[model samples]
Target: MHADTFGTFDDTLASGPRRTPLHALHLRRGARMVPFSGYDMPLHYPAGLLKEHLHTRAGAGLFDVSHMGQIALHADDPADAARALEALIPADILGLRSGRQRYGLLTDAAGGIRDDLMVARFGDRLVLVSYTTLRAPETGADL
Candidate 1:
């Protein structure tokens, strides 16, 4: 679809791009590689976005999410961990059941978003997949 978040150049084909865990698989599948978030992510494969979207909706598609930061929080009890996390975030982490995951935002005390994270509850730990670092509101000066 849109290419704004995709790589910057085709001329840098000879230049090395950061690879992900699925880089080899993407090449084998004819994926169009693009620089994204400091990684060479696949923009689309031979199937293209439409076909990929359809197939993913109908079945499954392997995605490279290695660009995200992952962290694990462990406690003697899962509820303890959830409570600790809820203290920092406004999310209802305590409401999550084992084997369940939910999307939530990590907000600052002033309500500014620090980051968006996916939290999954396991036995006695929470696995957090953070999308990115804090995104401060853009100032007009940057424009």
Candidate 2:
């Protein structure tokens, strides 16, 4: 069967579900695509989830998470930006040095995790990346 049978390839416009840069490659490799967040994401390959999981457990796996949210926080002082972010998440953003990254959790007022994220400190800014379902605009607005 054709790979297109796995998912529709209607990613020609800017308004609907967005396609990652690797969309075509995924189709060629028999990735079953599904709508995720606002993007067309691969659910699995032709190998099936169980076999793929076992294969990865036995060795390694490459995940395509290009559809995840990425928000960049910039300020006159990077430390200031980090401090601002520190108020929201549980990570020590202020202690994150340049060229370093840390895993963090976005928590509710009661200390429940709302989302998991990765914070990376560049020289001039801190970039926050959220998981697949978290959109950049929503996460940025929350911060």
Clashes of each: 0, 0
Give the per-residue lDDT digits (tens) of candidate 1, residues 36-133.
75578889988678988999999997767665555566566667767766865678988887788888777666887767767777665544434441
Runs of candidate 1 with Cα error greater than 4 angstroms are: 1-16, 133-143
User: On residues 5-25, what C-alpha lDDT tens digit does candidate 2 reach at each position?
Assistant: 112233354587788889999
Our tally of clashes for model 1 stands at 0
TM-score result, candidate 2: 0.66
lDDT of 2 at 44: 96
Q: What is the C-alpha local distance difference test score of each model?
A: 0.62, 0.70
Off by over 4 Å in 2: 1-16, 54-60, 97-100, 131-137
Best by lDDT: 2
Q: How does each model score on TM-score?
A: 0.73, 0.66
